[model samples]
Target chain A: MKNNQGMSIIVKTVTRVSVWLMVLYAWYIILHGHLTPGGGFGGGVIFAIAMLNVLLAYGSEFTEKWLKIRLLHDIEAASILLFLIVGILGISVLGGFLTNFILKGKLYELISAGTIPIFNILIGIKVAMSLFLAVLILAKTNIENGGEV
Target chain B: MMPTEIWLIFIISICIVGSIVALELKDILSSIIAVGVVGLGIAVSFLILQAPDLAVVQFVFEIFAVIILVRAFLKKDYHKEEPSTINKVLVGVTLITLGAIFYLSLSVFKLLPPFGQPLFETAQYYVQNGATDTGAANLVSAIILDYRAYDTLGEVTVLFAAILGTLTILRIKKSKNSQEVTNEK
Candidate 1:
């Protein structure tokens, strides 16, 4: 008997492309968050969706290269550190904790929104990288343990 | 119809359906899947509630939970067992109780103001104050980092603790034979 549950190339390709589009769109949203409703977490998730799509479509071989699990994990760790350091800088410079008005730049620009944009970028990187690592680890470990539960 | 009301109803309905599905599934795998569906549905509902931050956090947590659960289940064996009449009645009662509690809670809390409104307003006020306050346009940053820095610090610490816990539990040890091979090489 033929199993109909197997993935098809067309479906996989469509999803993969859509996911990349979503990741790009998410970056656009996050970068312009000062003027719009989109923020770090939203963009991060969108990027993660694309990563997940790639994994689902091409399996482990694709993920090993594209996802770069170890590098992403390091990025996640570093981003968390960056977030902390940024917060500390804000507190030390502004004489209070996490205050970002210390270095307000031009409004509606990429560098505007004081510390918000930087924080957003850091959070976005951390979230996206962490999620990518989690997914990769889970997928690989699942294979070692057995098939999907 | 008001957007808020419509969203509220949507969230409530999703919750009800999700809970019922999660409770009623026979197999453990099926139940977990149902819960995963519930989680995603709730994450969408969080978006509708205008709590995008909460929604994102929920989305991430759900992904983590589902991955961990699936991995755990894969490592362990599972079986489908027949449900007895008592079990059915208990489940039904439990569902009804939970449903009633949720309905009452939502209905009772009419006109609950948005949580972040004050924070947003504070950021605006600070902006008007000029250089005295940080000039970040993102009000959330001002509040999160400046006004509530200690809280953020504590939260980060808690996150670190949690990560450490997860790593400890999840990390696998290399075999001595592998270690010897590596040493020889």
Candidate 2:
């Protein structure tokens, strides 16, 4: 059944083992963004790459079955809106746009930074969804225009 | 331990060689892989320069770039065509001009501060106070997400616009004429 579409069995096996690890690592980077080097944008790109690995290994039909393009589009827009709302909330509460309003916890702690981690997460979601959606649209369009996978 | 300048020079030299190989390669796939190697070299140089944040991003970005390029290549029929005489001349001229510009830029670098010494007053302030103010151990993250968040917001907006533009341009037209043609087929 898995042999009918997409790449060979070896590629599928490797992707299956690696994709989830990639996603988990991406989330780790986003969540630990404040304490680490990689932040939202970097983690988000990793997340999108993980999804792209799935798309490439299993074929578009398999990917579309689980990940709806419409849902991804909506989520991407919502993440941007949420990021803006976070900024506006900072303005309304702290009298400045994107102000660090929340309590600053202990240094080097997981929940130390007030709004940086939150912003990181929001930006992560936004970047991941937007990049994935753009690639998916382009791939779909290419297929429609009679290009091979 | 070897000096960072030595490491940087080594990595940058490797990157230059890799880029030259990428450009000169006839096979598209091999060229793409060579380009990926150049990106990896740049990431290493970033690490040597003490920019771990940029290094991580560059590493991951290199993977995505190579993957995307390979996918795009897979979609098109492979063609091995020699550069025409006009194109060869144009490329030679462009390279000469770029080399001249780069050589001229070397003189301008001397006017700037030496490596690892930032001239900006804001840099000192950010490095000194960023951790205490933002409570983030990483100063780079603190500066990007807290101190200068407006700049990041602008960058995100640009990304959003680019994505929107791609979607708009690539959206499949579902006009009546197209629908009729598909139906007829």
Best by the TM-score measure: 2
Model 2, span B75-132: residue lDDT tens: 6557443664565788789999999999999999999988777877867888888888
Model 1: lDDT of residue A93: 81
Off by over 4 Å in 2: A1-4, A143-149, B85-96, B174-185
**Model 1 fnat value:** 0.22
**What is candidate 2's CA lDDT for residue A103?**
96
- Model 2 lDDT vs. the true structure? 0.84
What would the per-residue lDDT of candidate 1 be over residues A9-127, giving only the tens digit for each residue? 89776876687687888798667655455566667766776776677666766667765667776787888788778877866786655666446666555666576677767767766
Give candidate 2's error at residue B18 in angstroms: 1.7
Assess every candidate by TM-score. 0.67, 0.88
By TM-score, how accurate is candidate 1?
0.67
* Cα-based RMSD of candidate 1: 6.6
Score chain A of model 1 by TM-score against the reference chain A. 0.78
